[model samples]
Every structure is written in structure tokens, then in C-alpha cells.
Target: MSALVDMNAKSGNLERALKLFEEMPKRVYRLSKFSGCSIATLLKVCKTTEHLHHLHARIIRKGLEQDQFLIAEFITLSNSLASLNYSSSVFDRVISPNIFLWNSLIRGYCQKRCFQDVLSVFIRLKRQACLPDNYTFPSLIKACSSLCNVEGGKSIHGSVVRHGFEACVFVGTSLIDMYGKCGHIDDARKVFDEMTERNVVSWTAMVVGYVTVGDVVEAKKLFDAMPQRNVASWNAMIQGFVKLGDLSSARGIFDSMPEKNVVSFTTMIDGYAKSGDMVSARFLFDQSLDKDLVAWSALISGYVQNGQPNAALNFFLEMESMNVKPDEFILVSLMSACSQLGSLELAQWIDSYVSKSSINIQQDHVIAALVDMNAKSGNMERALKWFEEMPKRDLVSYCSMIQGLSIHGQGAEAIRLFNRMLTEGLVPDEVAFTIILTACSHAGLVDEGWHYFRSMKHKFCISPSPDHYACMVDLLSRSGHVKAAHDLIKSMPVEPHAGAWGALLGACKLYSDSDLAEIVANRLFELEPRNAANYVLLSNIYAAAERWIDVSLVRNKMRERGVRKIPGCSQI
Candidate 1:
């Protein structure tokens, strides 16, 4: 039975092994019949916390609780299966732990991103007089790096020197990485310079460190000076140039590389996408032999960002036809494209696909995109349902819901939700204030609008942007405050944007104030020379007042400027 259990566990058949283990006692074969290797195999193949607990109890009943090797293996495996607390509880009961046991627990903590606990354990190790080996400082330094605890990292570096492990190549590389990540690139370089020997990783760490600090010049110098180069080093240089918006330079490095991988292609593609060069982005994407999900996402989003929503959807179809499952990011991009197109049919298809697919509906970003898509598609009820179903409402989700309400002219509900967001302790940013102010304009909430507007710069210290000014103008105009709206536009500290003028002009048309309409229209003509709506609005204003000659002049202005009115379309 013991051999059968071992065989089943080794074959990755947890159900059979667990069933056989449960039947072991009835067969008169105790757990002692299982070797430590056999027991370790069971630990490795544990399917759940329940199975782990049952196995642990059996190991304890067999008097192997203090078996150091078995306990170490359990802690390591538990890092992946159970929680770190389980590993901590198991570690606490060990009477005399060797260095291997200490390192295992520290490694588990590091893996779980419990950086402060790693420091706590290292402190305890010092008090216990257990000498740390070369394996010790790497995880400890990594903990410090993750926490950005440069002081702690420096202290650990001193200990590494005292323990004579500073000369170890692996330890030196970790120190270099730690210093680099912590924005102490000079210190990283110093460590690299002092090292008697360095590997490709050590050199790459230094290059990446320089890239992190935006010192691509020095990074390129180091890249040129390296005795050898790997794909990581090449990718780092490409990323540096791409970040600085120097796509030409990035492409230059990419073209010079002897080898190119998915990362290299993805970085360059993203650069071209951001620079609005979708032709180059698509060209590179098609040229790459290895197209991963990230590469596909980059190209799809690039098309969407470059104002090619149909292209994004088409590529998404291509990816699906090729058997590539879309992840959350790609799904979010698709939702954005559908929202841009304002296609209720496409939005419904995306919603249905999400329901039938493996994507997590509970994911916050995916849910947020779904909310936006449904709202833009004119399905407010579905948008509200998703908003209320969010497991945890983040600021982005709140903004999405509030904007949905604003666009649907449910301004009162938008204001209520904005207040709810405040009550829940989310401080509104510039984007939130802009959306809320637009809601006020749409719903004609003047006093509430001014209150939030003043609070933006006075209470939250967020200066009102041009969009805020435009919303305020629209709000006053909608309320028959034409003179007040014009005054506000004139007093704007920043240059009044075309939106502010457009709002006031709209009011002129509404009130048939042709004189002020002509003035606002002339300014808009200078600002947006090719805007057919501005010329048409001005012409309509003149026509409404029976000024036939002035209306002809406005139409002639459109002809002179060669501005053509785009025919409008309606969704079914």
C-alpha cells in the first residue's frame, strides 16, 4: 500500500494517492512503512490545504515532526500550496533548526513578498548565532530592495562583507541588483567595478539600473564596453530609448541586434504605437515569428489608440481564429474599441463572450470596461448592474460609473455617487472633478457645480483645467446665464479653449443673441478653421434672425476655407 501510494503520488494522481493513503491503516501498513522520500513525494503532490493538513497530521502521528529534512521540504512546498503562516507555524515548532531550515523559511517569505518578515527572521537568526551562508544574503538583500529599505540593504551589505561572502559572484550580483533597483546606481556601479569577476547577469543588472534612473547614455556606454552581451542587455537598451520617446534610436539599436526576441519586438511595437506610427508597429508585429499574447495586445491596442477601432476588432478576430485566448488586457482593449464605435451589438457580443469564456468576471478592470461599454452602448441598466456588482469599487470604476450617469443625463445620480465616493474616502482627482462638473452642466446643477469647482483648487489643490472651464461655461449657458458665461470666458487665467467659446456660442444660438453669437463664432473660426459645425451654427444663428446676407457670408466662409460638413449617422 505504501509503495502504491508513492507510485500514485509520483504519477501526479493525487486522488488515487489520497484514497490509497486513507486505506493504508485498514491494510495494517503504518506511515512508518513510507520512507521520507515517499512522504516528501506526497507533500509535493498535495492538491489542497485539506490534503496538506491530513498529511501533516499523519507525519506528526508517526513521530517525524522533528525530522529536519522532511520539515524543510514541507515548508518549501507549503510556500506554493498553503499560506506562509503555515510555514511559520511549522518552523516555530522545530527544536534546533539548521541553516538549511532557516534559509528555506526566509526563501518562502521572500517568495510570498513578505519582505519585513524576512528582515525579522534574519534578525532572529543573528541572535541565535547561526552563521548565514552565501545563500542567505541574496534573499535578504532582495527583501530590502523590494521594500526600498536602502538602510536595511546597506546594513545587510555590511554583514555580507563581514561574513566574507561579498566576494561571492552570486552575492555581488544581488547587491548590484539591489542598489540598482533602489536608485543607487552609482553604488551598483561601484560594486560592479570592485568585483573581481562579473557575469552577463551582473552586467545586465548594471545596465538595467542605469535605465531605471533614466541614464540611458551611461547605460549605452556600459553596453558598448561589455565583454559579452545577451538578449536581456539588448532589450534593456531598446526599452531605454523607447521610454525616452526616441523611437528612431530604439529602432537603430533593434536593427543592429544580431538576435531579436518577443520582448524586443513588443517594446519597439509599443514605441511606434505611442508615437502614432501604426504602420511601423503593424509591420514589426507581422515580421516577428514569435507572437505572444503581449505582442498581440500591443498591436491591437495600438490600432485602437491610433483611431483604428475596426482594425482592433479585426485583429482580435484573427487572434481568436488562431486559437489564442485573450487575457484581461486584450479584453479591456476590445471593450474600449466597442465603446468608441458605440455598437450595442458588439458590446452585447463582448458581454456574452465574457460570460462563456474563462476570463474572471470579478476582475476590477474587466468589470470597469464592461460598465463603460454598456453605458456607451445605451444600456444604462446593464451598466448600473455591473457597477453595483463590483466586489471593490476603485476610483477608476467610480469614475466610469459616474461618467456613464453623466452621459445618460442622470446628473443627480452622478452627484450622489460622487458624494458616496467621497464618503468612502476616495479623494477625487482632476479627471473625477471634470466628469462631475460635466454632469452638473448636463443636469443644470449650477450651485452644486460651482461648489465642486471651487473645491477642486481650494480644498483638493487640483487646479481647474481648461475642460473644467468649458464645463462651467456650458453649465451657465444652459441656465440662461449668457452674460455670466461670456464674463467667465473672458476672465479665464489660461487661454479660453475653443470648447468654452463653443459653449457660449451655443447659448447665443439658443437665446437668438446674434450679436454675441457673431463674436464667439469669429473666435471659433480662428481657433478651429476647419470645424463645419462652428460655421453651420453661426450660419443658423444668422438665418434664425432673417439676416440673409450674413448667412450667405458664413456659407461663403465655409467654401473659402474648404471645410465640408460630414454627414451624420444614427445607430439603430
Candidate 2:
């Protein structure tokens, strides 16, 4: 029986080992002696949480829960569980855990982005006087990076130096990453430069750090100078170029690479998608080999980004038919496509799947996508419900819900949600303010709009960005405050953009202010002379005020400038 259990464990045949355990005679074999190893092996075979719990109960029945090795194995298994709350409970029960057990919990917390918990565990480890070795710093550093805790990370770095693990490859890489992520790019660079021996991971970490901070030029420079380049290095540089809106550079690198892997292909595809060159992206996607989930997601996201949500849906269907299992990313991408396409039926189907499957869609980003999808699909009620259901909501979700409500002419509801978001202590970004202001404009909430606009800087500490300014201009202009809107634009710290002038011009036309209209028209022409719409709009305003001479003058100028109005074309 012992030989059979050992063979099954070695071969990873947990079922056979379980059957052997059950069939063994109690009188001949001592069950207590080998229960820990057998239970660990059994837990590995159980894939679902339910089965894991069942096996855990069996381990308790065998009185193996107190064994240190068995507890370590259980921690490892819990770490593999995707749901944070479920695994967190298992981690809480481990009695007097060792270094391995602590590391397992830290890794799990890092995976779940439970940074506070990770820090708590690190603090507890310190209190226990558990001198951390090389294995300790990576997860600790990862937690600090996730939390953007530069001070905590620096303290950990001090500990690493004191413990003499600063030179360790994994520890060094993680420290570099932590500094880079904490907005200390120079420190990140210093760490990278000081490393006596750099591995692929260290190089990749540096490149990724540059990319994260939008320093694509530095990232590219490092990519060129690296002595060794792996798939991750190539992916990092390609993704960096993509993020910088250098699609051409990204494609150049993609072509110049000695080898292309799935990540590299996905990066290029996403680049083309984001740049609105879906045709090229689709061409490359079709030519690629072994389309994995990322490849499929890239294509789906490309279609959604390019406003061809139906195409994205079709590709998703094709991917399903090809037997490629959809991951969280794929589902989120598809959900976004469905929302953009206004396919409420599809969004409903996805919602059902998310509930039925054990997928962790509680991530704030994913929930944002879901909310955006539901709202864009004209299901504002469901969108609001989903927003309310989110376990951890962020500003993006709130902004999305507000925008959805505004689009559906439910500005009051949007304002309510925005208030709720503020009450919940989430810092509203400029985009969130813009959406709320737009909602006020749509609902004709002039007083509310002005209050929110002022509060943007005074109360929220969010300075008005270009989009925010645009929204304010639109609000004032639409509410018949054309002069006020013009004054606001002139008072802006930065130069008002073409859209700002365009908004004032729209208001001038509304209020029949030919003098202001002409001034705005001239400014618009200088800013965007090729915009035939601006000339036409100014001409229409003159015609409305019965200023035939001015209308004729505007028309003559448009003709003399050879600025032809683009023919409007619509596709069904």
C-alpha cells in the first residue's frame, strides 16, 4: 500500500492514490503516518473550491491539519484559488506558520492586489523576528509596488541591504520594479545601473518601468543596448511603442524582431487597433499562427475600439467555435464590444456567464467595463445595479455610470451617483468631473454645473483638463451664457483649443450674436481652416441674422481658400 501510494504521488495520479488510501486495510497500515502527504496530493487533484473544502475536511478527519507540511501545502493550494476572500480565510487559519507559509500568503495577497494585507503580514513577520531570506523580499517588494508605497519599499530595500540579499536576482528585479512603479524612475535606473550582473528579468523590469512612466524613449534605448533579448523584452518595447502612439515604430520593431511570440503579436495587434488601423491589425491577426486567448482578445478589442462591435462579436463567436476558452480579459473585451454594439442580448448572456462561472469579475477595471457596456447598451438600470453591486468601486465606474445616465437623459440620477461616489471617499478625476458636468448640461442644471465646475479645483483638488474645460464651455454655451463662456475660455491658464472656440461659436449662433460669432469663426478658421463645417456654421449664423453681405463674404472666402466641405457619408 505504501509503495502504491508513493508511486501514485510520484506519477501525479491523485485519484489512484485516493483509491489506494481507501482500500488499504486499517490493521496493516498506519493511516496517521502518511496522511499529510496523501492529503496534499488529494488537494492538488481537486480543482474546484468545493472539492478543496471537501478534501480539507477529510484532512481534518485524519487529524493532519496540525502538520506543518500539510498546512504549507494547503496554503499553496489556497494561493492558486483565484477568489481572494475564499483563499484569505484558509490563510487566516494556518497556526504559527513558517517562512514558506508566510511567503505563500504574501504571494497570494500580491496576486489579489490586497496590498494592505500583504503589508500587515510583513509587519507580523517582523514582529515574529523571522529573519527574511531571499524568498521574502520579492513578494514584499511586489506588495509595496502595488500599493505605490515608496517609503515602505525603501525600508524593505534597507532590510535587503542589511540582510545581504541585495545582489539576489529576484530580489534585485523586484526592488527595481518597486522603485519604478512608485514614480521614482531615477531610483529605478540607479538600481538597474548598480546591479553588477543583470538577468533577462532585470532588463525587462527596467524596460517595463520606463514604459510604465511613459518614458518610451528610455525604454527603447535600453532595448537597443541590451546584450540579451527575450520574448518579454521584445514585448515590453513593442508595448512601450504602442503606448506612445508610435504604431509605425511598434510595427517596425515587430518586423525587425528575430522571433515573434504571442505577446509580441498581441502588442502589435493592440497598437493597430488603438490607432484605428483595424484593417492592418486584422490582416496581421489572420496571418498569425496559433491564435491564443490573447490573440483573440486583441482582435476583439481592436474591433471594439474601432467602433465595429459587431465584428468583435463575430470574432468572439468564431473563437468559441475554435475551442479557445475565454479568460477574464476576453470576456471583458467582448463585453465592451457588446456594449458598443448596443447588443443588450449579448450583454445579458455575458452577465449570466459571469454569475454562473467562478470568474472573478469583481476587479474594478473589469467592473468598469461591465458598467460601460451595460450603460452604452441602453440598459441603464442594469448598469446602475452592477455599479452598486461592485465590491470595490473606483472613479472610473462612477464616471461611466454618470456618463451613461447623461446619455440616457437621466441627469438627476447621474448626479445622485456622483454624489454617492464622493461620499464613498473616492477621489473623482477630471474625467469624472467632466461627465458630471456634461450630465448637468444635458439636464439643463445650470446652477449645479457651475457649482461642480468651481468645486473641481477648490474642493476635489482636480484641476480642469482640456476635456473638463470643454464640458464647462458646452454647459455655459448651451445655457445661453455665451459671453460668460467666452470669458471663461479667455481666462483659461492654457490657450483654449479649437473645440473651445467651436463651443462659443455654437452659442453665438444660438443667441444671434453676429459680432461674437464672427470673432469665434475667424479664430476657428485660423485653428482649423480645413474644417468646412466651421465655415458652413458661420455662414448659417449670418444667414439666420439676415446678414446677407456677411454670409456672401464668408462663402466667397471659403471658395477662395479652396476649402471644400467633405461630403457626408453614412454606412448602415
Q: In TM-score terms, which candidate is top?
A: 1
Question: Candidate 1 residues 1-572, lDDT tens each?
Answer: 77898899989997788777767663343434455566787988887888788778867766677878899988888888899989899988998788899999999999999999999999999999999999999999999999999999999999999999978999999999999999998899999999998999999999999999999999999999999999999999999999999999999999999999999999999899888898999899899999889889998888889889999999999999999999999999999999899888899999899878889989988999999999888788888899899999889888888888888789999999999999999999989999999999999999999999999989999889889999999999999999999998988889988999999999999999999999999999989999999999999999999999999999898899899999999997
Model 1 residue runs over 4 Å out of place are 1-71, 411-427, 443-464, 525-572
| Whole-model lDDT per candidate | 0.91, 0.83
Per-residue accuracy of model 2 over 26-103 as CA lDDT, tens digit each: 654345656666666676666667656766677666666657667767777877754667665665676776787778
Model 2: residues >4 Å from true position, as ranges? 1-261, 267-280, 306-308, 338-358, 423-427, 461-473, 480-495, 511-516, 567-572
For each predicted model, how many residue pairs clash, with residues at least 3 apart or on different chains? 0, 0
Total clashing pairs in model 1: 0
Tell me the lDDT of model 1 at 371.
90
